[model samples]
Structures are given as structure tokens and as C-alpha cells.
Target: MNWQSIKEQLITFLKDEVKKTGLTKVTVGLSGGLDSAVVSVLCKEAFGENLKCVLLPSQYSSDGSIEHAKEVCEKFDISYEIVEIAPLVNAYLPNMEHNKLRIGNFSARMRMSVLYDISARDSSLVVGTSNKSELLLGYGTIFGDIACAINPIGELYKSDEFDFARFLEIPESILNKKPSADLWEGQSDEEELGYSYKELDDALKLLVDEKRTKEDLVKFGFNSELIELIDYRIKSNAFKGKLPTIAKIQWS
Candidate 1:
């Protein structure tokens, strides 16, 4: 995919966007996942010492995730801070039943809140790590992982992200680990979605990028059920990708 060329373009994009915003620094939530790791590397290249990587680990975050995130910061020589969000999350949902989805969404939002606050404190813009696959499928929490000042990887699909991460020399541990939001123990992105990223990305390329119809997908050897499910997710979660709707009032 000409990753070197793409990498140069992305680094340039980050720098130009930050300049346009009149911001001198960039902040990112380093999740130790491929997506965030790639963004961190790009931000490091673009901002150099001006990049601030923050680790907002919740109670559910695994030790391995935190360690991996720190490894990226150390490897890149980027400045970072770890802000534990467990206290805040626990205070908010002390007695609630343990719901994986609910807790995960809340954790995402809390982490973002920490990032935005850090951005303000550091006078830096928040860089997003969400890839095109998640955005298209509405697989992220609204006002959470989806929130950012600028997204360098939002247009790259998950599979493309993996390639880019490797090209950027992200730690093999991060690149090889199962993709997760780390919202809970034993949580995996593919397991939750019921499809591997490679499978989903292939279908998405046909369905969204190539604008293929369901019949065309089936003709291309895609299962009807999978196509239907993906199409439904895209349609249903469309709201997450858009600004809030406002009612138009007629003047008297």
C-alpha cells in the first residue's frame, strides 16, 4: 500500500492540521493497541517533543495494556502521563450491575474526558486513533473514542492500520495482540463483533469503498447473513459518525 508514502502524508497532515488550529502540541490516548500505537508514532514524527501521550487506564484495564503503552512512549521518547480513571468510574457507577457494554462505553467516555482535559492543560490538540473500519461500523462510543481534534487514521481501515503499524515499527507485542478496547477483561474486538477484521474489512471494501450492492456482495462470495449484519450495523450506527440533528423552524 506504499506505506512509506502514506506515512509521509499522514505526518504532514498532522503537522498542517495542528498549525491551522494554532496549536503547538498534540495529545493522544495511548491504548497499547495497534491503532493508537500508529497514531502515537505519527504524532511523534510530526510533533517531535511536542507530543504528549497520556495513558488513561481504568479499573478494567490490564497491566499488559499499560505496559505496552509505556513501551511505545519510551521507544519513541515521547512525554507521557498515566491518569487512572478507576476512581472516577467507580464513583459514578458504584452500585450498578456489571454490564460489559455499559461499563465499556462509560470507560471510553471517561478516558476521553481525561484526554480533553489534558489537551486543555497542555495546550495541545487531541489526536484520534479510530480507524475507518470502526467509524464505518459505528463500533466506538459516541463522544468517547470517536471524539478528537483531528484524526490521522480515521480513513485507514483496520487491516490497513495493522500494516501501517508494522511499517512504523510498532512493538510486535502490540501488533500481535488481539485487538481490544481493553474495556474489560477477556474482551476482544473481533469476538464482540462476531467477525475478524480481515473478513469485515474485505466486505467493507466492497460494500462501502466500491459501493457494491448486497446482491453483488453475494455474487462476490460473501455470505448473505454477514452482509446483512454489516449493512445493518452501518445503517444503525450512522448517527455516531454525524453531528447532532437540529430542527429547522419556520418563520412566521
Candidate 2:
């Protein structure tokens, strides 16, 4: 994937975004997961010590996730703060159904809130950590993990993320851990999505990037129902990938 070139582009991208925003620093929510760790490294390389990592752990967040996040910060020699969001999430969601999705979404929103608050205080832009796979699948909350003034890894697929991560020398534990949003206990990303990345990426590549129709997908051994579901998600979640739509009254 020409990681060296990708890294160069990413560094330049961050620098341009920083200059565009007129911000001297960047703040990011570190989930102690592969995506965030890779992003944190990119931000560090781009802005050096001007990057701040905020580890916002909620009640569903595992100890391993928190520890891994701290370890990445220490290894990268970047500044970080561990903020517990269980209290705030709980306050808003108390007596709410123990819906893992709800809890996880709330956690994401709260963490972004903290990061944005810090970014405002420091005059820094918020760097997003969501990878392309999640973005494609509508797997992230709209204003939560999806919110970013700049995102360095949003274009790389989950598979490409792993390759780039290896080149960047991220920790083995994080690289090897099962991917999750930590929205609820025992929730694995693949399990929720009902397919492995190998399958999902292949389908997505054929469907979205290659413009394959359902008939084309079925010939490729994709179940029609699953193909239909993915097609719906892609169509329905188009809003997530776009800026708020504007109505032009007289410009034309």
C-alpha cells in the first residue's frame, strides 16, 4: 500500500488541516484500539508534542482498553489524560435499558464532548480515529466518533489499517486484540456485523468501489439477503459521509 507514501500524505494532510484551522494543537479520543493508536501515532508525527490524547473510558470500557491507551501514549511520548465518563453516561442513561448500543453510543458522544471541550480550551482541532470500514458500515455514531475537524486514517480500510499499523510499529497487544467499540461487554465488531472483515471488505469492494449490482454479487457467492442489507446501509447512511446538505435558493 506504499505505507511510506501514505504516511507522508497523512503528515502533510495534518499539517494543512492545522494551518487551515489556525490551530497549533490537535486533540483525539484514544480508545486504546487499533484505529485510535494508529491515528495517535500519525498525529504525533505530524504535530509532535502538540497532540493531546484523551482516554475517555466509560463503564463498558475494559481495563485492558484503558491500559493499552495509556501505554500507547507513553510509548509515543505524547501527552494524555485518562478521563472517566461512567459518571456522566450513567447520569444520562440511568434506568435506561441496558442496551449495549445505547450505552456505547452515549460513551462515544461523551468522549467527543470531552475532547471537543479540551480542543476549544487549547485552540486545537479534534482528530478523528474512525477507520474507513466503520464509516462505510455506518458503525459509528454521527456526532460521536464521527466528529472530527481532521481525520488522517478515514480513507484506509480496516485491512489497510492493519498493514499501516504494522509499518508504524504499534503495540502487538493492540494489533492483536479483537476489534470492538467497547459499547457493551462481549460485543465484538464482527459479531455485530455478522461477517468477518475478509468477507465484508470483499463485498464492500465489489459493491461500493466497483459498482457491482446484486446479480454481480450473487455470482461472487454473496447471499442475496446480506447483499440487500449492505446495500440498504450504504444508501441510508450516505448522510454520515457528507456535510449537512444546503439548499440553494437563488445561486443557480
Each candidate structure's TM-score, on Cα atoms with residue i matched to residue i, is 0.98, 0.94
Residue 47 alpha-carbon offset, candidate 1, angstroms: 0.4
Measured by lDDT, the strongest candidate is 1
| Candidate 1 structure quality by residue, lDDT tens digits, 58-123 | 879888899999999989898999999999889878555787788899999999999999999989
Candidate 1 residue pairs in clash (backbone atoms < 3 Å): none
User: Which candidate's TM-score is highest?
Assistant: 1
Show how many residue pairs clash in every candidate, following the order shown: 0, 0
What is the alpha-carbon lDDT for the whole of candidate 2?
0.87
- The worst-scoring run of ten residues by lDDT in candidate 1 lies at 92-101
lDDT for each residue of candidate 2 in 1-252, tens digit (9 for 90 to 100): 799999999999999988987778999899889999999999999899899899988878888898999889888898998888889898988666877677788888888899989999988999988887788888889998899988888888887688899999999989998888888777799888887777777788888788888899999789887788788878888799898999879875
TM-score computed on alpha carbons, candidate 2: 0.94
Q: List the residue pairs that clash in candidate 2.
A: none
